[model samples]
Target: MPSITRRRTANVGRPTSAETDILAATQRLLVNGANFTELGVQQVCTEAGVARSTFYSHFRDKIDLLVRLATELMTSSFDVTSAWKPSEGVERLADAFLQVVKVYREHAAVRRALTEVATYDATVRDFWSQELNQFTDWTIAVLRAEQDAGRTPADLDPVSATRLVVMGGERALVDHVTAGDPHADGAFARELALTWWYGVYRRPAHHGERSPS
Candidate 1:
């Protein structure tokens, strides 16, 4: 008679090193535009150098794995901009704003692919929407702080104003990625950000105050 070892139930729920490999491989494949439908479980398992059973052990299916990968990408990107702080005035804001646009533009390929995939996919769409809202809220908070410090125009409403700024930045990036010109788009985005900052946030001169050259 052959002797068999039974697996523990407690150990069944945990992700193995193989699952981590599959997740990382899935992200790389997706970023490279690998056809998810054509690349079935066996393909992914082979790509990750894992057994088929190991792949199914961690994720319900490819979509589940893809969603997790997308979430990871968004979380990582958010971390990059989470520490943003606007300096003394509009000019400083423009500089910080350009840094963000530049980073987005550099990651244009991955961003575009994920955004396009999100359009028809409910899971991806929800993930993107939640991330966008979080980012917009952060922007609103920064603008509110600027307003309180009197660096931003007192008349501007932070909530509505921040939404407008977010929309503008979103549209700019969408257009840039769609156009296939990340460099030009980045430059234009920076200029547009500067324009919006100066137009909406700059304080008006007091009565009898001469304009500085």
Candidate 2:
């Protein structure tokens, strides 16, 4: 299967100045409490201090721009995840998760806008899911490696565990930022780290059976 992450402009790297300007502009409006659906391209271009033509050149539509923002945010989080080692203690993993939390908090507005837009937009929804699915693939690999190394228990199905953790962890991370409580961020990150560490990587034992599919 091809990676949704294999989409264009990915290997090309981060956005140029014009793209950054427009993305930053949309984030500003959302930060100021403007409804994302109510925001117009003209208003965004105006905020960006760029021409409407520039906006059109950079993005096909607002949904596209939101997807770009999501991509940037996910890339940062994935980079952090890549640094983590199963051999490292849960505290170390907590530190890695905290870095991810900081990334989300840094662009809390864009994060908020993307989630809101996704609710009513199928394109955004699928794009976001595909992005998470990409991470799920990476996570499954890591879990399998840990099992081979005798860290994670073999009883757990890596595929099923990866889906549950990736999807659930994505939602939890987004909600953690949305709640906007800095005080809870650390605890939340630690809890997530612990869940991944003991709940999967070091699970004691488990059992399951298949039902009609």
Candidate 3:
């Protein structure tokens, strides 16, 4: 009798349509409240209609997939806000913040998923940190230009002040979104923006009061 030998299958490195389907399905599941701990590779394969071996061929694990999805979300947000321009003094800031809130509210499912995942994932946290820093830098540039033109308070430090202002706006929106309050509207965002401006911009000295020259 002739000796029989079995050969191991070679790994083909190219991504297949099945892998794309799995990633897309995973994103949808995440948007629908399947927490990271609950997200298993098997479940993802089931949802995507793929075999277990197929998933392993594309991704090392669930965290790796989560990192990719989170990065996409952050980059998309940056793209949406890149065209932002302030029209009036503080109103511009208010409008810009409200725009962000509106976009998040419209896609609350995905936003909530990203928020929850970022809380525990270091990679997601780093992605958000970098994105937020970029946003703060952009805001500082706007404020600095206003200061140069005598629109903003001369005593304020543009860079530090802008960070504080952006933080306030960001937190206010997060609170509104997470609160899930039925009455939550653009009013809260507008108020928060105005409050920030009041602290950063100087009011003219009252008549008969000596200007602190």
The collision pairs in model 1 are none
Can you give the lDDT of residue 30 in candidate 3? 72
lDDT of 2: 0.79
TM-score of each: 0.68, 0.85, 0.67
lDDT of 2 by residue, 1-213 (tens): 333322344224567798889988888888898888889999999999999988877777777777777878888998998789776667788889999999988878887777788788887778877877778888889999988887777797999888878889888888888775899888888889878876777643231211112
- Model 2 CA deviation exceeding 4 Å by range: 1-14, 203-213
**Over 4 Å off in model 3, which ranges?**
1-24, 50-60, 88-93, 106-120, 201-213
> What is the Cα-based lDDT of residue 51 in candidate 2?
97
lDDT of 1 by residue, 1-213 (tens): 111112111234445687679876765665577765456788778879988888767776665665555555555546655654554444444455556566565555456556666667775566567777887888778778878997787788878876776777676656765574655644564565555556555555442223322
Evaluate model 3: give its TM-score: 0.67
lDDT string, candidate 3, 59-132, tens digits: 66665666555445555555655565533445565666566676666555555665777678775566567767
